[model samples]
Target: MTIAEDRAVELQEQIRLPRSMRLRLTRNGLTLVPITQAHWTTQRRIASQIEERLPGWTAVGEFSVIPPREGYSPEPDVSAVPSDQVLPDASKFQEDLLRFVVEVVSPESEERDYSTKSDHYALRGIEAYLVVNVLTARWTLLTRPQGGTYRHAVTGDFGEKIEIPVEDQTLVLDSSQFMRV
Candidate 1:
């Protein structure tokens, strides 16, 4: 295992995070972040919307995604994977199985969401990464991952529609009600 992976394992074994907290291995090191009420509410709403629209896909809130790259295990606020795909491990979802990931930007996670995660997710070849900034009432959709970056990005206000191409179909998410509580 890589040095980062070893460190991640050590941290996971050493720290006992609360149920509302998540441990992430970023470029710098391990980080534990609390899930605020607003973050939870928004994630649940979005996950429900995705699951309702995409019948064959499973949308889950706040799950660990183990990417192949070292020094990065991000738990997206919402992660969608094919329902028929059998998971090798029930506790962790492999990066290859993730079709889409959403990160709801919080005050403390603006940079991590807008920059760090965008680069990392693209590098891992995640088909789509959506950044929902409730603070600014805007959203950014990154698609066409190539060369460790997204080739295309579309940004719009919360009231607009964000179209995401997932597999053979397009998932249209209506962001009209997304806001900070």
Candidate 2:
């Protein structure tokens, strides 16, 4: 087999999802964003912040974060996956996957999530990468394929509303109420 074909075959084997793991995915492939205790605190804070600042959005999902290493794609907060399609095994991308990976932006985890983790997601073509920039009390949304790297696509403050287009329905951030203003 040629080098590329050999690699693709090898990659397929490694991408299988683990039996021990419990995962949820969007129809596209996968999506997870775990909400932990700390994430709860921060997420609550963020949610309230958004609700107070904006009036129309809904604080639907919020996550407490944990540190994530390179090549990991955390589960999306919620994946709108269809029942018919099977989820691609994560083993192939474990080196590049996290089941809803959320990183606490504490000083301790700064390097891992912002620089290291971000770089890792870009390499794997992860569908979503959200940097809950806790410091500035803001959230950043990064998406789309840009020069093969996940560049800083957009930034929103705690008060702003983020409208995510899903089917005919609209998913608004509803974070305006969370803002202190």
TM-score of each: 0.87, 0.44
Where model 1 places Cα greater than 4 Å from the true spot, the runs are 1-5, 86-89
TM-score of 2: 0.44
Query: Per-candidate RMSD vs. true structure?
Result: 2.2, 10.9
Ten consecutive residues with minimal summed lDDT in candidate 2?
Answer: 90-99
* lDDT tens readout by residue for model 2, 51-155: 444334333332212233322323323222222322344221232222223333543444555665565556555544666655555666666535446654677
> In each prediction, how many residue pairs overlap at the backbone (N, C-alpha, C within less than 3 A)?
0, 54
Best by lDDT: 1
The 10 consecutive residues of candidate 1 with the worst lDDT sum are: 62-71
For model 2, the stretches where C-alpha displacement exceeds 4 angstroms are: 1-38, 44-104, 146-148, 164-170, 177-181
lDDT, candidate 1, at 94: 86
The lDDT per prediction is 0.81, 0.43
